[model samples]
Target: MFLERYHSIQDNKVLISARQGSLFAKEVAGDFNPIHNPDERRFCVPGDLLFALLVAHFGLSRKMTFHFRSLLGDSVPLTFREDDDGMIRVYDDRDKVYIEVEREGESTRDQSIIEHLIRSYVAESGKNFPHTLKPLMESQGVMFNPDRPMIMYQSMNLSLTTLDAPEPELELGQATLVPDGKRGNVTLDYRLMSRGKEAGLVSKKLVVSGLRDYDPNTMDAVVEQFYRLKEKAWD
Candidate 1:
């Protein structure tokens, strides 16, 4: 599987290196979040990578919800366990849960379907920063602190009407942001389509911290720096 190179399985435990996490964030998901930088002091593996790994391991169910508990660091040994009640947990040796998954209905292990959904969803997710979140923040007259902007994935829920699509694509639907003082919650809704037919719906939630009054010029500069980092990494 394509995900094998991004993570390693040893003795029933999964391990992800800093380099591997960084590569998957930048190269595969097109996510340029500074937290995913290998050399950064606050480096953390991208939550999307963990979500992908879960699907890769357990297969995609008709309905699934993923809740992120903690930030995963590089080289952490993780154990994935599924209970009889359809709850899947990914924890470390210390038994600190990093992610919790709830799955229901039928599932499929078809590689083509899984790969297509993973790529499309992550690609759409990678555009969350300037593409989706920017306008949503602007609408609320709020923006993340330019110097120390922080956006954390909270949870994602997926409900599929059918999983028969061989190659489904994810499309952005309605997105909303609700602010409370200095913090804000963002909900991104997406539509899953295959051959022009609706197959599923997905909702992803994120928490933005240190929000301030929206300043277009500052936000633009911040976005520019983000692209510059991506370019530097690619070069």
Candidate 2:
């Protein structure tokens, strides 16, 4: 899996490097968040990377909720342990938990199904800044700082009434932005699609801080820069 390349499995613990996390964010998730930059002072691993890893290792669950408690730095070793009650925790050597996950219902080890879900969800999420956030911010009369944008992934939850199908996809649902001074909370509601029907719904939250008045020129440059980075990677 592409995820394994970003984190090393050693002694039953997964170790992530700055370079690996940065690449995964930009290349795989198409997320250009500055905090994920390898050279950033406060560089941190992408929650999407951790989410992909969890599904890759533990398989996809019908109903799952993931809560991120802390930011994980480069070269940090994480241990994922599953309890008897089906609770999962990603922690450090100090046992300080970074992520807590609770899964219920049936699970599937089908790699194809899992990979599709990961790709679709991340692609849908990567569209947040431009396709989703632009209109959202306009409605609220607030936007992110174009020069030094900061969007933090808080947590995500998904629930499915039943997982009786094999194919899984993601459909964008309602999105709302709540303003709190210079920071805004972005809640994206989406659904899991299977066999041309709604299989589950997912609610993902993000924190956008350091907001400012909308500037079309700067935001245009920012959007262009993101695609340029992704395109260069493909080259």
Candidate 3:
């Protein structure tokens, strides 16, 4: 019953900017401060804010495939904890989220499990961190008849750094990323594929949008909005 699968931050590129606490937490504290903005009384949490920032920093992917320029340069170890229970487990001492790709032929579509685990992980995480699938679900919701998503078999480099590449004749959706990192040429497109049939259902260049802070208060509201779109975003 291989339905669908996903990959999070799987590289060793996560910058460890804090000891007792992560720098990400510190950033969240400032932005998600409840008292900071009286008009914007909502305020986010360190964990939730960190996740959103990762989405922004990493550049959203179509079926979970991130752009090359958005990740750590050269070689980075793709790592994450196994199973949904321990997947998004954000430890109080560590402000980080683990990422991983399932083993071959694995049924990655487990929305109930995903929702449950995320909910539990953030249950006591404060108003800022709403542990639910509302946000992600709003976009893609759930891949019910989840088909096999594209598997990136290989990625390479080319001459000319700063310059960009011509748009591919074939693609499922729009793909883009922050252009401030690398330089020289840009004739390369991070190619991708599906591990199963019906590969065209997904885009070769997936664009995963980062978490958005709202003018309205609370992460719960964001979660509710996520599920509405997640089911169709992939389509």
Candidate 4:
């Protein structure tokens, strides 16, 4: 699987190195969030990495929900456990849970379906910054620090009416960012369509910490620089 390079599995435990996580963010997800930079002092693993791994291991379900509890760093050993109820949990050495995945409906082991869903969902989710997020923050009158943007994935859930259709696609429906002091919670509602028909709805939550007052000029510069880096990467 394409996800093998992002993590290592040994003795039923998995670990994602900083370099691997950084590559997955930039190369796979096309996300350039500073928090995923390997050299950053507070670098954290991308939640999308965890999401990919979960599906790769257990296969894709018609309806799924993931709850993130804590951020995982490089060299942290994570163990996966699933109960009889079909709930999967990823925990660290101290028994601290990092992520929980609940799946319902039928699960498919078809690699093609799994990879297609992974690629499609990650691509849509990665467009958060500088695209969907910029307008959302503007409406809320708050934004993250331009120097050190700290946006983190909080949770995500999707309910699909049918997974039988092919060519699944995601489209942003609505979004809202609610600020609480220097922190804010972003709720993005999206719709999943298959062959031009709506098949499901998804809700993604993100937490932006270390926020500051929104400055139009500063935000404009940030958005410009973001695309510059993206362009430079592909060039």
**TM-score for every candidate vs. truth?**
0.96, 0.89, 0.18, 0.94
Which ten contiguous residues of candidate 4 have the minimum total lDDT?
Answer: 158-167
Return the lDDT, model 2, position 4: 74
For model 3, state the Cα shift of residue 210 in Å: 30
lDDT of candidate 3 over 25-110, digit per residue (tens): 22222222221222322222233233333333332222332122221111123222334642222222242233322122122233
Q: Which portions of model 3 show Cα errors greater than 4 Å? A: 1-12, 19-23, 29-46, 61-97, 100-235
For the record, the alpha-carbon RMSD of candidate 4 to the native fold, in angstroms, is: 1.5
For model 2, what is the C-alpha lDDT against the true structure?
Answer: 0.84
Model 2 stretches astray by more than 4 angstroms: 83-86, 164-167
Off-target runs (Cα >4 Å) in candidate 4 are 84-86
Clashing pairs in 1: none
- Local accuracy by lDDT, each model: 0.91, 0.84, 0.25, 0.87
Assess candidate 3 and give its lDDT. 0.25
Candidate 1 structure, TM-score to reference: 0.96
RMSD of each: 1.2, 2.1, 19.5, 1.5
lDDT of 1 by residue, 7-33 (tens): 988888999988899999998889998
Better of 2 and 3 by lDDT: 2
Better of 2 and 3 by TM-score: 2
Off by over 4 Å in 1: none
